[model samples]
Structures are given as C-alpha cells and as structure tokens.
Target: MTAHIPQSRFAPAEVVTRPQPGTAPTDRRPLWTVIALTAALTGLIMAGYVLTIGTWTVWAVVAMALITLTTLTLSLGAATAVVGLIFPAPRAPRPMPDWQPSSRTAILLTLCGEPPRGPAAMLAELAADLQRAGLDRFVDIFVISDTRDDKAKAEAEALAPLIGSGAITYRRRQENVGRKPGNISDWLDRWGGDYDFMLPLDADSRMSARRIRHLIHRMERSPSTGLLQSGMRLLPAETRFGQLQRSAQRIMGPTFLQGFSAWTGDAGNYWGHNALIRVRAFRDAVPLPKLSGVAPFGGDVLSHDFVEAAWMRRAGWRIEIDADTRASAEDGPQTLAEYHKRDRRWCQGNLQHLRLIAAPGLHPLSRLHMAVGVMGYLSAPLWLATLLLLATGAVPMAAGWMLLAVATLLAAPKLCGVARLMRQARGLRTKGVVLRAAALETVLSSILAPIVMVNHVVDVAQVFAGRDCGWKRPGGASLRLPTGGLEALAGTGIIALVAATNPSAVVWVLPVALPLVFAPLFIRFMEAPCACLMARA
Candidate 1:
C-alpha cells in the first residue's frame, strides 16, 4: 500500500474545521516522459547536425557540435514545457473540500527602495480583503525594509500610518548585508518562530484574500509542503515593452507552468516572491551557507530561492508552484532597458548557482535545475561562437536540413503554445488577438535575440571576472539606450566581416547584426513614451 502524505496540525479555537482528504498524488510518469522526449529530440538534432558538418575543419566541426548540443539542451526544456501543457499536472494539493486555516500566517513584504505609496496601497487593499473574509485575525503583514537611502527610508517610514495596532508592522535594517536573501534571513532569524507559515511578497506583489486563504488552506491540508508558489498574473502595463512582455506571458505562461509542474511535482523550485512557506521547515532546513569565494559566483548566493527549495526538498519537504490559481499579480518592468538591467543581476545570480549544483544532499532534479540556470547565460556565448565560426567560413556552409532541424527545435514549442491557446479559446475574438500577439512577439523576439545574446555574453564574462552585480531596485529611472556606442561599432564590425567574406550569408546574419549596429536607435524607438502609449492604444 502507498504511504499517505502527512496531514497538517491545526491549532485549537479556530472558527472553521477540516475537510475529507481527496487524493494522495503519487505520479512521476509525466516527469520521466518529458525527460525521455527531450533526450530523444536532442539526440536526433545532434545526429542531423553532425552528419551535415562535412568538409569543415575538425575544430570547426567540434565547435558546431558544441553549439548544436547546447542549443538542444534549451530546446529540450521548451519541448518538455509543451508536453506539460498537453498533459498538465495538478500543482496545488488535493482540494480541501471545506478547509480552514488552523495556523497564523505572516506576510513578509521585502522592500528595497521601492516607492512606499505603492506597497502601502497594496497593503490597504489586502487588509480590507482579509477583514472581509474574517481572516484578518489569522494573517498579519510585515514590511521588512532594506533601504540604504535616507529619502527611501523616510518614504518607507511614511507607510507606518497605514499599519494598525497589530495586524500590520514595519521594520528596516540599517545595513542590507546580503541583498534580498540576507534581508529575508535576518527576518527569519528574529520573528520567524512566532508564525507557523510565512508568505513572502515582493514590493509589487498582490493577491486577493480568497486566494491567500486558499493557499493557506492548501498548505494546512498537506503537512509535508514546505513552499506553495503562486503563478502571478502580470498587472497592467503602461509601456510598450511591458505590454508585449505581459501579453506574451498570458499566451505562453500556462503551457510552460503546466510542463514545469509535471516535471518538478513535489520537488518544484521557487521564484523568490509571492509564495507561502512553512516557517519551521524553512528555518530548519534551508539556512543558506555562504560560499568560500569572491563576488558573482561565490560570496552570497544571489539566486537563493532555488537553493532554498533544494534544501527543503533534501529535508523531505515538498516545494510546489500552483499555476492553476490566478489571484496573485505583480508588475513587469515597463521598458526593455529596465528589463535588461534586472536581467544583468539575474545573470550573475544564476551563474552563481554553478557553485551549489554539486552541494551534498541535493536531489538530482534540483541539480538539473541549477545546471539549467547556468546554461541560460552560457548559451549566449556559445551562440556567438557558432555565428563567428559560420560567418568566417571556418565551418562549411550549414546544410538546409540542419538549419531546419534547429529552427524546428527552437520554434515548435512556441507554435504549440499558440495552437493550444487558439484551441482553448471560447470565441474568435481571443483567438485573433492571440494569433496577432504570437506573430508580433515571434518577430520581436527574433530581432531582440542577438542583442540579448551579446548582453548575456558580456554579463557572464564580467561575472567570471568577479564583478559585483549588486542590488538594483527597479522603476527608479527612465529608459535610455542601455546598449549604444561600443555595441553598435561591434555589430558593424561583424556585419562588415560577413559582407567581405560572403555576401550570400549577409541575409542570414543581418537580423542578428542589425540590433547591434543600431542599438541606441532601436532602444530609443522601442522605449519612447509615444511608442509605448501607441502600443497600448
């Protein structure tokens, strides 16, 4: 007989009681199926590309092989995600029928120079919702500030008036030691023992009381769950980049989340914010140990959420993302420049995961998760290497069939997402919008790919060189050309080389080269206030 997942303990004097347990959830088939499919597809593409590398230098052949393999690794993930959409798994625990919270929860809101009014307003809204649901007594809010600036600190202080006697509290650390992870650890060390569950939210994160209650209910029903991450819907976007980013997310997020849930199951990862965690489990199992090196890859674990989840899983607790829920929301960056700026820090943090991928007691899938994070940045340099080899005729002309295979591997998952959305639509109206959005996004992504690749390549290099990608709070500055002079000259230089070497290759390489050549102009146009307004219109 299968062992039952542990049931949670409830405190006495609760108004509501428990419900009948529904299902035990013991399926790993979908995860293995996705892995098998990815491997098969990657192998097929690698074989096709290897067969086509005739007449090239051995080094060039090796370079092509490496590129093909790396690219396929990413492709395999996409394919797995598509498979997830097709065979979606239930991410939340079995429905708790008439479940009610049996423990107090603390909503830990982390602040780092964010506009205070925004969060204060969000808190008011959340408080009102909880009071209406009769859960104000069960849940309390904590604003943990890590702001170093005086003005920002004062701004955070202004939020104190919004807090009542005990339901809401505010505290700020004078020195932000390890950025966000450190800030969180500081709070956990001091006040974590007082609460049974802790729900961490970013400054921009928002969720309804009902949704929050549902999450707590799910957690209380499953004692083994260490984390319950909600998939947040992006709030309204006032700028062009934000509009496109959120639109793309709406179209593709579900399918991707479904696949992710399928593979990760109870061993899922965290996305930092908008997630509920068991206080005791987190405080006990996931104490982040400082690595023994310098900046970027060593010092503080920049990407601590993944590692924390790994540790929790190692200690026999479940970490899950409930994508089926839709009440949680957060803001996306309004411009491409802001997005890339955030990604710069993310790049460093993800690269830092290389140090912990081999940490003892971590599960195999958890190791794969960290390895994938490392590849996310490394793939850019590999792509650039492949392009340089092909552009300089160091490699023989890539066969049409091989290129087609590569395209299929890269594009098929996106097409599948679009197809899935269209099929699920209730009317022609949504279908039309989705089709337009998908096509537009596809074109935009192609245009932006090379520029982002170059950016990541630079970031990864800097990271390895021990560059400090410190804390940067978003929404502080307006968009300007993040990539301009040097990038433009480099793009032109590459274009010139391609033209002089092989004019026939110009068309194939032009799209990748143009964004670099006109980096400032592209950034300016894409981020101009008018363009964003027009996109919204």
Candidate 2:
C-alpha cells in the first residue's frame, strides 16, 4: 500500500484515507532467457576480439582475457551478495525519533546562471511541501546567487520580500570566488557550521519538504551516517521525451539504489543534495581541494561529489547510499541544447577521474564504479566506431563475424543488467507499463546514443588529447526553455532502428537501447508522475 495523497503545505488536500491496492505486478519472463542472451553476447564479443587480433595466438590471449573478466565479475558479485547476506543491514528501529528540531533545517539554494525560473519556483515548491511535513519552523532557507550580472542580482533582490523575513536568506556576492564548489566551500567555511542538517539544493533539483524531513529523521535515528543521498526524480512534464526518461529512471533507480546501498551498507556515501547530512562530519571530512589550474576539471574536482565521498571514505567514516530512500527530486536539461551543455561538463568531470582510477583509498567497488562511469560514456563512441568500421566493406568477412561476435560481448552486461533489474522487480504487475516505456526509450536512445557517444568521447578524447573543450553554457533559464527538437528527432530515429530487437529471446532485452537515445528527452520531463511513485518506489 502506498500514499496516494502526497503531503503538500502550499496546497494540502485533506488526507483522504483511501486504499489503492495495486494489481499483482506482472510476471516478468524467465531468468534463463536473459542468461542465454548473455552467453550469446559473450560468444559474440570473443568472436570480435579474435577477429580484431589478426593471429590465432592473440585470439588465444583474448579468449583468456574474456574468461578472466567473466570470472572476476561473477566472483565479485557472489562475494558481495554473500557479504550482504551474512551481515544484513538493520532497518530503521521503531519510533524513529521525531528529530524535527525547532532549530530549523536550512534549504541552501545555490545558483550560477539563472536557469529556468531562478531557483525560486523550485525553492517555493520544495519549501511549501517541506512546511506541510511539519517542518516550516525548523526550516531556514537561503538562495545563494553567484551571478555577477547586475540584472540577475536585482532580480534576486526582488525575490527577497517573497522569501519572508529570516525564513529565507538571499546572499549575492559582488566577486564570485569559488565557482559552484568554491561557493559551497566558502559557505561551509563561513555559515554551514550553524545548521544541524543542511539540505543542499542545486539549481535544477526539487523535492518534497516531507522528503527532506524523512532524510533528517533517518539521520537523527542513525547517528553514525554522515550523509544521505536521496533517490533522485526528474521534474517538469514538458515534452513526451522527458516523461519517458523520468518514468524509466523512477522505476529502476530505486532498485539500483537498493542494490548499491546494500553493497555499501557500512561504507555509505552521499550525492551532494536531495538528502540530509550531518553538517559537522561533512565540514570536517569533505573540503574543496585547493586545486590550482584552469576551469572545469582543473580547478577543484569537476566531479566534487565522488571526490568528497572518497575523502569521507578515506577518513574511515562509512558514506552509504540508501537506494530505497526517497528524499529528493531534480530535473534534467529540458532541450537538446541544454542536454549537451550538461553533457560537456559531465565529460570533463568524469574524465578527470583517470588520475584517481588507480587511487589508493576508496573501496575497490567505488573505484570500479568510477571507472565504469567513465567507460559508460566513452564506450559508446568506441562501440559506434567499431560498428561503423565493421559495417563498411573495409574488413574481411571473417573479420566481420569476429567483430559482430566482439560486439555481442559488449551487449552481455547490459542484458544481464536488465535481467537483474527485472528480477529485483519481481512480481511487477506493471510489466506491460514498464516494458512499453522501456521499448519507447530503447528506440529513442539508439539514435541519440551515437551522438552522445561521439559527443562525450570527443570531449573526453580532447581532454585526454590535451585539447581545450571551451565551456559554453547553453539555453538561459526561462518559463519556457527550448524543447523537443534534436533530442526527440534523434531519440525517435534511434529507437526506430533498434525496435527490431523488441520481441527477442528476452522480453526486457529491448531496454538496452532505451535510456541512451531518450535520456535527453525522457529525463527532462517527469513521466507518469503517479505511476512513477508506485512501480518506481
């Protein structure tokens, strides 16, 4: 049973005591189907490696490497499952102390460029919702403006009275020192010491104030945890593309988190915001490194969260992820232009990890996670290159089969991933809903996949190659930002091409291509908001 009438302070509907027992979530297909496809993927990959290597001896080596990889993967998974099973995490103890301190939780809203609505609307929505959660008095809000633009400063000033006396704090800097991370670091240096649990708000992120309270409740109850990273949900229902992406994430994100958190149990972590944190621990542990260099990844880690997590880990404090925890929500870029703007920055940040992929401190799994994150973005281009190169009548027919087989290897993990998610989603009555959405996302992802792959690869490749990737912010914030052009076209085109794989050996096989193509669109809009709460929850 789930709560249908979500709590909202700005507009609270009477808690209509209603029962909405759902249909037994649909029976997802057999595990074997996925396993078999996985094997096919492996064989195909080995075939490619052998074809690529030119000699039988090299083929033998490749064969050994593939075997090693497969074995290692299986062993790691088995070990993790065993560990979790042996030391199952304890749930929230009864009577989670209503740690709703009257001292107030600060809603820290930091802004760079006025992206869509100047963060006020987001703050208002979140503030109202949080107030309804019986946290208004315990809530102190702040909107940090780093934009040196006089007009933007004036605009923020105009928002002062609306923000309410002391309830909201609008601090604008005449000289913006630390970009975003710097800004946050300065805050920590100056005022972060004041609050018990500060809720960090990004320009794009939004959440139910109730969610924030839940995070605080969890934190107060579990004193050792330093930070809480909430399960993220994208906002807005603008384009059809965004909706598709958000729905898929809403459904799968929790399960992924469940597995992730379960794995990180004692060694938990944080994701900047959408969750609450023990400000003291974060201040003591995570600090913006005195990075001296140029912009993007150079000055202070572009990927500050991972580094901060790593820093916390190094300090022997466990930073865990509650994959099941629902604490926050945020929106993705709404349009193609906006999407790529975000992508470029992500590429720079992820690639910066190349230096630490072999770093000493982090849990081995965190290392692997970071590596995979980088590879996921870069792999697309390599995969695309391999396919395009093979597709051309350039290589020998034998080479083609070899490449096809190699390509198959790459598909194995994804197929297995789909299966794992499905299994976790056992007894899903919404299989059809999930599958339909998955199918749509797949086709959409396919076309855009190439573009994103190449785009990210090139950006990272430039960084690796020591070429400058000039930072260019795209699409200013407004009531209506650009939407539904390149991403939709690219997504639809990509999905259409990959649709052939839908009624395959495995029912969920279709989603492999879904997220990539449709991410720009799907992630931008919140799809099936209500359904998302259920299946995704």
Candidate 3:
C-alpha cells in the first residue's frame, strides 16, 4: 500500500504511506465561455461610457482609462460570478465509496507572536475527536514557531507537557527567515520525509477531526490535486463590525467561492491555511524561489501561498477546494483599525504579484491568477482616480449613468447568490433570514467602504514608494475619535469640494462622503462590546 517517491534533496525522507489516489478529472471548457462573457460585458460598458460622453479631454481620457480597468476587475467578481451561479459546477470532491488513505498526515500550526495555549488547546480537543474516530495513528500535530517574542516562545515551549508526548511536537527557528513560507519550508526539509500529506492551519484556524478525516479521504480520491483547500467560516464575533462582516460572509462567501471554483476547476488557488498538501508534490514543485532585489516586489515573497500553487501547477498538479465542507472557522480582526492594519499588509503582498504575472513557463490560468491578485490592490487607485475626476467635473455628466450601470453589475453576484441560496434551502424561512441579513450587511458595508478605500490608497502609495510594511500581528483595538477623523480627512476634503461645486452631486457622493465624515462615530458605535452582545442576543 505504501508507495515511495525517489529520495532527493527536495524530500530526503519522503514516503507515500498510501497508494496513489484516483485523479479527480474535470472538464474546463465552460470556464472559457464564462471568461469571454465577462470580457464582452466589460467592453460594452466601456463603449457605452465613451460613446455617450462624446469627448476625449485629457482628464476624461484618464477617467475613462480608470473606469475601464476598474470595470474589468469588478466584472470578474460580479458578472462572471453571476454566470457561474446560474450554471454551477459539479460539486467538489466527496468521500469515495470504499477508499481510505494509507498515508500519515501532519497538521502544521504555524505561529508567529501568538500565545501557545490557543492552538495547543484546539489541538488537544481535536486529539480527542481523532481518537474517537480511531484516526489517531495517522495524524500528528506540529507547532512551528517564528515568534521573536521571548514570552511567546517560552509560552509555546511550556505547553509541550500540556499537549502530552508524541501526539504533538514544538519547534522554532533562530532566524525567522522568509516569514511564514520559510517556517513551513523548514519543516518540510526536516520532517516532511515522514508524512505523505500536510495540513497547514493558521494559529486562529480550527476544523473538526471528522472533517479532517473526510478531507484526507477526499485527497485519497484525488491523486492529481496537489493541494485541497477548505472553505473557512468566521468564528462567532463580539463586535458590530465583526458581526457585519460575518453576516456578509455567511450570505455571500459560499456563492463567491463556488463561482471561483467553477472557473478555476483543477487550477484552483490556495489560501495560506485551512488546506491539505501532498508532500512530494509540494516538496519538489514549490521550492520557494526568492524574488530578485529587496522589499515590496522583491526578496522573500510576502504572499507565498498563491505563488506556491502556481509552481505546483506548473509542474503538472491540480489544486482544488472542498466546497461542501465548511466547518472550518477562524477569528477575524474585530475593529476597523485592526482590519486596516491587516489589509495594508495584504495590499503590499497582493501588489507584489505584479512581478510574477508574466513569469515564464506559467500556465495561462496561473498568470491570470497573479494578474488578478495585482489588480485587487491596484484597482483601488484606479477607483480613487475615477472618483476624483467625477467630483471635480472633469468627466462628463453621462458618467453618472455609467456609474449606475457599474453599481448594478457589482450587485448582480450578490443577488444571484441569494437566489441560489434560497433555492438550495428549499424554504421561505431561509429566504427571509438571508434577506434580513443582506439588508443589514449592505448598510454596514456602505459605511465601511470609504474607510477601506482610503486605507488601501495609502497602503498602495507606501508600497510604491519602496516602504516595507513587513509582517506584524493586528492589534484589534477601537480607534479614538481623533485618530479616526485623521483617517477620514481625505474623504472630508472631497466632500467639501463636491458640495461647493455642485449641490446636485451631493446625493451620489454622500455614500462615500457620509461614511468618512462620521467614520469616528461609526467605529466607536461598532466597537462597543456591549452593543455587539445585545445585538447578538
């Protein structure tokens, strides 16, 4: 039953304890149709704007260019997603009739500055679940730390006795090296020889042992899948902003991910955690090549998971998500300040993907993934440009109609998702709940959007100026009124200009401006723990 790959520097002790599983085959022809449709929709909208405007002034040209780019990016999330919802893909990999894995799987908990008690306690509970399923023998837990904090390191070392003997092991690096990717790569170099699969989980991540077994079984049925990602839900939160995001995610996240899965098929992307990876495939194919030069776009890649998936696929492997499984959950940043901190780091990391978009020998889909990552952050600046032009009367008034069309396109995916969810639930009760949640989410998000936009603009500017954000844990603290107002100043200035130039424009501009004007109050209200608890009750 045990199949072993040839031992090399890539995996000195690699062993396949199980027979190679069957490859999960899929037809991807429909994906292209969806892509073409998305392109056509974006082009038609752009053409409508330019033709209606009937002028090509320098400012108009810049605004139109921004509009075109932002629309194309938005279309991927909206119009094409709506198409995928309308015609969903075959369901994700499920348990095979009589197949079981013969391989040992390592559950890696990568930590950096986090206290050990949290992950250790989670694993201890998981140990009991695995024991109940009689799968204890096939799994082991590893707490890999890159914590520079002495107290955190000490706390992690002290938890060894609590986790018991061989069921768990603790290891740390003297030098943090390439951040998270380095910590994981180091483990593979040292301990990867013993296991056929690795499930990398973030410190905040949790998944039941039954689900873990199911994931392994699914992988056993999917020989070609280099990595299998799971849908992660947000944990129950105790803050208004947290609750808002959680509600939005509950309503829309599955549909969004399913649509992505439909288009991606075998070329699915990898999130950093809540995923399983085949040892040999990852070891050989994803060696974590260092980018040339220094920080930002160069040196050690900030977003290693996406690039790793691309590298594995380049070496002939498939990546997929187990959409049917959704028990995995993690805590999110509770406050807007914390969210901004997290996003700033992500913005820099995503922007760095520009360097890899055209890397030689990449699959076209892989290239598209990189380009999408780059645009996720780059589009913010483009959006900012469009707003500035519109507010200053530099663009045509017909731009208002184009904006209306864009808003419709943006809402299409959510509308489709709710419709699909209603159908799947097969009852009016679920539909009512979804609608109520959607309305509340829309209101909360409208306020949050301007704050996020301004933060991303600053983050992108800093990254472009060669400023290294580096990695830091998010401190989930509510901002005082002063700090919050400072963040809102740019939006305040824009609103003032809009009010002075054209009173009629205030209605369209209020959505963005009102959020910024009252951002401090919004943050304070949403950050109130008591209010959050009352709302939950």
Top-scoring candidate (TM-score): 3
What lDDT does model 1 reach?
0.74
TM-score of each: 0.89, 0.69, 0.90
So what's the TM-score on candidate 1? 0.89
Better of 1 and 3 by TM-score: 3
Ranking by TM-score: 3, 1, 2
lDDT, residue 505, model 3? 73
Please tell me which model should have the higher TM-score, number 2 or number 3: 3
lDDT per residue as tens, model 2, 54-126: 4445334534454435433433333333333233334643334465553335677777666536466666666
**Residue 44 in candidate 3 has what lDDT?**
87
Instruction: Give all candidates' CA lDDT scores.
Output: 0.74, 0.53, 0.75
Decide which is better by lDDT, 1 or 3: 3
Pairs that collide, model 1: 84-259
Q: Which stretches in model 2 have alpha-carbon errors above 4 Å?
A: 1-54, 57-99, 102-104, 116-118, 291-297, 325-327, 388-431, 470-537
Residue 383 error, candidate 3, Å: 0.6
Return whichever of 1 and 2 wins on TM-score. 1
